[model samples]
Target chain A: MKIIADKPKLLTETPMHYCPGCTHGIVHRLIAEVLEELGKADNAIGIAPVGCAVYAYRYFNCDMIEAAHGRAPAISSAVRRVVNPDNLIFCYQGDGDCASIGMAETVHACMRGENITVIFINNGIYGMTGGQMAPTTMPGVKATTCIYGRDPKKYGNPVHLSEMLATLTGPAYIERVACYDVPHVKKAKAALKKAFEIQMQKKGLSFIEVLASCPTNFHMTPIEAMDFVKTQAEPFYPLGVFKDITKEEANS
Target chain B: MAKGKVEFREAYCKGCSLCVNACPMKILQISKRTNAKGYEVAECVDMDKCIGCASCATMCPDSVITVYRD
Candidate 1:
């Protein structure tokens, strides 16, 4: 007998609070798998934000702290300074928390090259807050606040956080991936693994932006939401490594 | 023939049917019965056709599906 696939030990048995078809569970499992594979579960500390993934502290089996709204980056920065160098510290934040309210904390952390990992879930809308418009919301996408579809004239353009963060020289690794389908899911997992590996190597900040699905908020079925991520979000956001100083370091 | 089985954690299943769509062998379907959480859960309708590719399990966001191979 062989176990083909089993739940990662780092994920608590608790049922996730995400609505049906929400891809947050996939990202959580990938992170949990990486934490277990890299032997970081024992010492890893995850900073959870106050959005859709606010209950992450209860889901991830490792030491987790619930940070104030969008303050995960700041909190993780402090944790990185005080904790032992070998311990892994990562912040799991939603687009609402990381890109909107906590934009300053996020930018400063990357600008200073903080030695921490950041898992950013960009589902476009502010999921936990009744699907309001977020900084990462795509153009023409309607949410509770943007009932008439987001108009660039008034709201401005969606902020491409990963690309913006890559512009700074502080981060050692930054990649954008999505959980739309099987192949994309695998790629997202691989990117997450690389992020964790960079952290273990004492490299600078490693940020991964995962374009997740908010089916309930999007008023679409789970399958339809996944399709939207592939067809709509991928074109606007694009996927691939934005920066990898570690690779350059190896070459240099 | 390969032997494999999948167990669904009924309590955790949201019955989104992503797993059903992911099944390559078309062995999965939403059960008419509902779990304690009141959401329908996916069930293996034709166990004999299961290849145990674990595609259903992989696509499951809830991590409710577990695969075993023998």
Candidate 2:
């Protein structure tokens, strides 16, 4: 039999620390596949964030740095400037890190249009910290902090980070995708590959916000959590390309 | 009549059932057998039903499933 699908060589044999059915693993696999396919797996540097994927450095079979909480963007920017120009740099961050604590870093990185890729996972609740309410937590969603369900008046509305970042002129591409199913997973992989390609072309930042699920924290089965991401989360944070300079150029 | 075969790295399987749900052919199921981690593992009940779509592998968060086509 011929192999139709197999694990990418860029991923270490270490089992991921993410909970069962966590979409983070899928995203990690996609990044590894993209890097390997682009022939940059050997020359890539990844910045692991301070969230549930804090040990991400151990998973990707490449040089990795553990960035302080919400500081991955800052670290990535600095690394991008000093690393070999051919080296591919990317940062993996969660909603709590990217949209809440590191909001400034994320915004400035986009505003500067750093030639790097940022994979943002927006799972609504803060998974690493026991499902606390995050900046991206949808209104009325129940979390540890907002156990009674998030009140828009008290917690304010969820942050539309991708849309906000897309407004910046520095970024070359910005898109939001989900991986609750096969078709969406394929699209997310395509978007991730495009992000890496854009960075290789010396284009500005390419930010991809992926809607993920937290089965353990959400107190739901893996499949149910995925359905929640599809029926509940997707409606609030619609999936599509928020900005794409190449598309704009093609249109113009 | 099997067009494809699926193999599971049982050690890495979390038995999340994502592959079971993603299998369009409905041939995947969570087996009672537990892995070293004590989580149940997924198995293909009927290889003949597999169409080599690789949907199960694509949805498997742990990347435990590998697909091959005849």
Candidate 3:
């Protein structure tokens, strides 16, 4: 019988250690699927930051670089500029590392129009290192930092990065996709492939902010976290192409 | 007629009752039987009325459900 669900060639054979219900595995598979489809797995370089997905370097089959916490964007920029200008570089980061601590770096990267594909995983709460409040945490959602609830007065409202980053002309493409369900997941994978293509074309910065789930941090079972992502988080981070600077892409 | 097979992975289910309330077709109901983790499972008895809206799978928390249509 054919192995329908074997690990993707873009990913190592190592088993992922994410929580049983976490969507990180699914998101990783989506990126790997894109890489495999494009045959760019051999040429691609991935930058992983110091958050829950810190050890992402181990899972991705391609050449990988581990960056300092909240520094993947800068590191990716450096990688693209110094080593190989023509190479495809992608930075895989979580909300804590991207939206919170590395906010300045990401904003500057987008503003600079760096030719890098940023696969941002926004699950609201920090997953790997403990359930901490992230900048993308939805209003009224509780995290370890916000025990009572994310008081908007103190924490402020969630920042929609796909929309916020798209505001800059530097980014060539910006879109939001989630793995809450199969159809959304399929769309998410397609957007991811397109984001990678955006970088391959050397058009400019391409950002795919995926709203993921953290059941362990969300204090819900994996299933419930999936529900929360679909029902709660999606409203704040509506999916679709938020920006496409290239005329052909914009028209397409 | 297009028949969609909805597969629910009970292992990741948290039983939040959102799918139960959100399903407009009323095809799914909380089962009296519990799964390995002791959570009430979501079940669909009469899938004939399913419009293939995919709202339940979309609204599920664990990313457990995969719907295949034929």
Candidate 4:
């Protein structure tokens, strides 16, 4: 028998601590597979954010650093300058860490065209903090802080981080993808591969915003949370490549 | 004979059922059996019906399933 599919070697034997059914696991697997396929598994450095994936350092087999809350991009920037040019640097961050507190760092990284990859998990709520409403929380999404659902009038509108960053001239690639099903999962993996490839080519920053699900915090079954991402989240944060310098150059 | 076989790393499975839903052949189901974590693990009810598609493995967030084919 031939093995058609198995776990990526880049992922450690250590079981991930992400909550059951959380989409973070899928993202982690995708990143591992991408790194392995790119032949950069040994040369990859990951920056773990202060969120549900704070323990991410345990799962990835390569070098990993735990960055302070909303400081993953800042740390990634420093790592990029010191690491070998062939080495791949990536930051894994959550909406709370990337869109809220790390907003300035993330935007500046893009503006500076830092040659690194940022995997942003936008789960709409702060999963590690008991489902507090996040900066990317959609209107009418209930959270601990917004028990009655977020009110745009009082809380302001959800921030579209990818779109905002795409407007900058620094970033080389920016895309929004989701993994609610098999097809989307495949697309997400493809996007990750492209992002890493861009980084390896010494292109500018590549930011991928993944619309993930927080089933445990959402008070829904895993399947139900997947449906929520497909039905509710997708509509608000449409999926597609927001920016690609290669495409622009070709068009020009 | 079945065209494909699937294996489960039960220890790593979180029993989210995403793989069951992703199976195009509809042969996967959440079993009454639970892992050490007490989560109901997914099992292939009819291996004969598997088409060697890795959809289940792709959709599985925990990477619990491995697919093999002759």
lDDT of 2: 0.94
Kindly indicate the candidate among 3 and 4 with the higher DockQ.
4
A1-252 per-residue lDDT for model 2 (tens digits): 899898888888998888889999999999999999999999999999999989999999999999999999999999988989999999999998999999999999999999999999999999988989999988889999999999999989989999998888999999999999999999999999999999999988999999999999899999999999999999999999999999898999
Error of 2 at B6 (Å): 0.2
List clashing residue pairs in candidate 3. Answer: A222-B62, A223-B61, A223-B62, A226-B61, A227-B60, A227-B61
DockQ per model, Cα: 0.80, 0.89, 0.09, 0.82
Give per-model TM-scores: 0.98, 0.99, 0.78, 0.98
Q: Which lDDT tens digits does candidate 3 get at residues A14-95?
A: 6555656567777887788788889888888999988878888988988999999889999988998887666789999998
Q: Candidate 1 — what's its lDDT? A: 0.91
Local accuracy of candidate 1 as per-residue lDDT tens digits, B1-70: 5578888888899999989988888889999989988998889987777777888888899899889888
- Which residue pairs clash in candidate 4? none
lDDT by residue (tens digit), candidate 3, B3-51 = 5556666765556555665577778877877877777778887877766
2 or 4: which has the higher DockQ? Answer: 2
Task: Give model 2's docking category.
Answer: high
RMSD of each: 1.0, 0.8, 5.4, 0.8
Q: After superposition, how far is residue A245 of candidate 2 from its true place, in Å?
A: 0.9
How high is each candidate's interface RMSD, in Å?
0.9, 0.6, 6.8, 1.0
Q: Please, what is the whole-model Cα lDDT of each candidate in the order they appear?
A: 0.91, 0.94, 0.79, 0.93
